[model samples]
Target: MGYSKDAEHVGALGAGQIAKACNNYLHWVHSASNVEALALAKRYGVDAEKMREVLLKSPGDNGTPRNFDRYRFTWHENDIDLVLDLAQDGDLILPMAALTDQLVKPITQGEVVRLLGEESCVYLGQTVAAREAGLDD
Candidate 1:
């Protein structure tokens, strides 16, 4: 009844915290990407829920799309901050982590549900229009 098979020592002390931060970073990235993909599908006149169902069966499947509704969306900022800080300390550049940090704020603010809802196509359309207009710059 233990984690004998699932556990492995990664490194010396403090490594576990780093590993946890890395895992959290990926979780945030994946969850954001899942919402964005579904929103894209909804924009293209595809049923996002149906697309999600298909994606759940595909090689791109991750538990995010399935468990998205139940996600707490809390503490992500702190976790990503830790990851970014660690990267900075190591003199590394992680653009995806930076982007995830930005995306997580809106997701935590309940934007994910809005982005996946029925009216999301309009929102996505406007977003695309804005980007094309160079408003995103």
Candidate 2:
């Protein structure tokens, strides 16, 4: 942990906060990736729960990477805002993160399941309807 005033660690006051923001940003990326993948799976008739199980045992982080158990250590409500604030201050543009942020907003706001949203369901249904209507080959 970087402290404000100390000879031990050479850093300023916002150092710890910056570290936290970066970590949270990475968490957001991973969480959004998992949610998007699951949503796509459900769209194609694969059982969501079964796919979650498969992801958990895939590899890395002892299954934490694919953990669907919500509200434990997932992104809090203000986390993304904080990260975006930091990015703005640093003049950084995170386009992918920004895009994923919109994709997972409903889940974070508790409008749907923690990692799955009704929006995905609606989108998937629309795709199916279009296909049935011979919109695509």
Task: Kindly list the per-residue Cα lDDT of model 1 for residues 50-114, writing each as its tens digit.
Answer: 78889999987977788676687888889899989999999999999999888767664345555
Candidate 2 Cα outliers beyond 4 Å, as residue runs? 1-13, 59-67, 72-77, 108-137
lDDT per model vs. reference: 0.73, 0.55
**What residue pairs clash in candidate 2, if any at all?**
none
Roughly what TM-score does model 1 have, to 2 decimal places?
Answer: 0.76
Clashing pairs in 1: none
Q: How many steric overlaps does candidate 1 have? A: 0
lDDT of 2: 0.55
* Residue-level lDDT tens digits of model 2 in 1-137: 44445433326986866776666767766666665666566656555556677777675233434444454534544777777777788899978667756655644434225324332343212331112223234
- Highest lDDT against the true fold, candidate: 1
